[model samples]
Target: SILKKGGIVPVFEPTKATAATLALELPLPSEDGVWTVLYPASAKAANTLEDGLCSRGFVVRRLNTYDTVPATWDTATLTSAQSTDIVTFASPSAVKVWSSRLGTLTPVACIGETSASAAKRIGFDLVRYPDLPGMDGWVNAILEVIESSSSSSLCKHNFKA
Candidate 1:
């Protein structure tokens, strides 16, 4: 939808480096032009995209869409999660929620760098994420962690998406 409307997206991977470089690549806004940004409500308040675009002379209209909220888990579910060999997370919110609830030292396998970074920041000792972001990459990361463990037995994995 954004592409059809002629909106530009960052070509580089989403990281601090990309954010810095993206500022240099954005085109100067036309006179009195406004850019509407639809973003997740859970995203950081200091939106880099809106800030960069506004600094480059565009009036940005930011809209908060759906938020990523923590899911409520029953005691039994939480206990099961704690017993797992590894926990897989698809989002930063999930990692934070899991850490808060279980506070276990079990290893984590993330679907992407963002989730992995969150897990590490939340004090998880062992975090793994694949180079690419997708189900295949996520599964590979989980497999890698499982394979490297001293136990050769099948791993009981817990997925939080």
Candidate 2:
């Protein structure tokens, strides 16, 4: 049991039924330092991830990504994109408090095909989505949209000089 103040919380073997939340099984917790960068602008849920890492005795660093796109591959490289008119969230957690931020403008995009499933579960009516999921997949998708937009812009500019 883990003692906190005057209370005791029993710790169960991770192999137990609570294991349902486990995203993976083979790779166990690491003793090495673990720093996680959370993107898509959800802070409260980030703490849960941080705490989990700390429970494993891992030094964790938390970084927030709230740039142009709702999410990205490189957490550090995730800067604001001025050209972003459409935004996507990686998962439902990213949208945990998104209702307050969804204003009258700006279209919404969702990460991966599975994100659609998440959105449906959360009842998000308007959300654009990517064909694939995860960072690499989402990055490729946003890159595609950027390239298309840039090319379209060039065509419209038609610079002679």
Candidate 3:
């Protein structure tokens, strides 16, 4: 809406999902126009699709607009807390943001394929993602993972509808 109404260049995260949205919404290769990407500082590579566009002669510029700082974990608090069953990540950045915070966990659920790939790269043992998209789909995938894993404790927590 912002792009169409106010001529605002869309600023997007570096992810397949964001790329797909941009491709569908925008016409590429404007000689005098610019597309800006707001990405994390720690990422090693540029946004995949945006960089691809630059190669193809589109003017895509990037800004390292954010940083991920893992929250300090307290040993005493964690030791007293109940064990986590499943950790959920909606974006690749979320996986990266939580990397230092996550020590060891099983049966991680990602919202989509891109995020699942990130989780796998981060050494999450069980990375599961929804076949469909969005929050409902991700939740269903998580439920499926929990059912398949046969974790009785998780099933007892009312995750199902």
Candidate 4:
């Protein structure tokens, strides 16, 4: 609907889902001012979709979107409790905000490469990103981490290090 009225959608190119959606939705190149619906943005895509669209040659008639706001965390209470086993971050913004409050979270599972990079840059040790790049993949990666941790305890008694 947005494309019909001259709006652009900048999707992440690294994910297969975005490519498939673009193939189905975007129109063929023509002289009609390049009425393309999908513009694949790499890891360094603009902060906002409207900015991404304009950067990629789409004329945004209106821009009414906002970035994700960071939520306040009760760090004092959390610091007294046990360390988190696994922390999942779906976006770079979440990683930024969460890491700033809580120094580092081990066994971190990020939804994509971009989020994983942010978490790692903030000193997260066990950050993992799925190869498939989706919600299911991210969940599976988290499950894998849990399973590995569970099994490691069984051999803790026999470990020399």
Candidate 5:
């Protein structure tokens, strides 16, 4: 098995559209057996992306991963912190994980509102999210924050520090 060959196979995290990504990724590679994937999307994600998957001959299912909000990322929180002023959920799956762990209402800053509202029934809220699509915006927001914080002495040479 690939697991035996490579140890535990890890899937990338913080995917906004886990199901979508799986639906796209699964068929590309050869898979076998009764395989299932968890897709955590807002109502819109659940509703809109279905036909596309069906077109590809996949049976995508939605799971209640209990992700309420997309993670608004603060580097400090990478180790210790109960919360943040703003968090970013780059993926819909990230939102689900945040929702499940934090139960929404955490004032998440996300890439878009659709992702924000995915967990709306669970009472999550969006603080300030980006409109530009994909990962570049997410990286920029984090960089902007890193630059603004006076106490953060992050240099190119000392990135880990």
Candidate 6:
């Protein structure tokens, strides 16, 4: 949306490495120039984007534009989630919240490595994440977990996020 509004043509890259390669192809600054980037507060701990760009001789100014907060789950929703065959987590915040509220007995499918790591640190025995990124990979990971769990016991094929 920002690129579209700014009339900047975007080269879509699926991974950070690919994006860094693309950034390397960009014209280098005559002098070190600051590139202002608006990012979510949740991702501040992993500033790979800024670090990568900076390494290419571009100064980066990151602005914390937003933050991710856990949503309050109602009693019925929480109960339903607890009974699910698997739980999917997109962010560490979600994993933390779910672990705190429901405990980590059910298996979890995480969207990315970061979330998967968080789940592991939180004492989740069964945590799965795809090598590839994005919703497609995330969904595939969930299905893989579900299939694996089904072999052990009767799985309802129900997943909650």
Best by lDDT: 6
For candidate 3, the 10 contiguous residues with the lowest summed lDDT are 37-46
Off by over 4 Å in 1: 1-37, 40-46, 52-59, 152-161
Superior by lDDT: candidate 3 or candidate 6: 6
Which RMSD values do the candidates have, in order? 6.0, 14.6, 5.5, 8.4, 10.0, 5.2
Q: Estimate candidate 1's alpha-carbon lDDT, on a 0 to 1 scale.
A: 0.68
Predicted candidate 3: what Cα RMSD to the true structure?
5.5
Cα lDDT tens digits, model 2, 41-99, are 33433354455545654455556544333433353333343333445766655554343
lDDT of 6 by residue, 1-161 (tens): 55678998766544432334435555554555565544344443566656777787666667777677778889899888877767898888888898999898888899888788889999998899987666778898888887767664434444332
Give TM-scores for every candidate, taking all chains together and pairing residue i with residue i: 0.65, 0.31, 0.62, 0.57, 0.36, 0.69
Rank all candidate structures by their lDDT, best first, as comma-separated numbers.
6, 1, 3, 4, 5, 2
Off by over 4 Å in 5: 1-47, 50-81, 135-161
Clashes of each: 0, 2, 0, 0, 19, 0
- Descending-TM-score candidate ranking: 6, 1, 3, 4, 5, 2
**Candidate 3 lDDT by residue in tens digits, 91-134:** 67778766665553657888888788888988887788876556
Off by over 4 Å in 4: 1-32, 36-64, 75-82, 147-161
Global Cα lDDT for candidate 5: 0.51
The collision pairs in model 3 are none
Clashes of 2: 2
lDDT against the true structure, per candidate, is 0.68, 0.46, 0.65, 0.61, 0.51, 0.72
Tens digits of per-residue lDDT, candidate 5, 7-122, equal 87655333443445544554433365444434565553454445456556556586545534455667676445343434566556777766665566544555655565564545
Residue 54 lDDT in candidate 3: 60
TM-score of 4: 0.57
lDDT of 2: 0.46
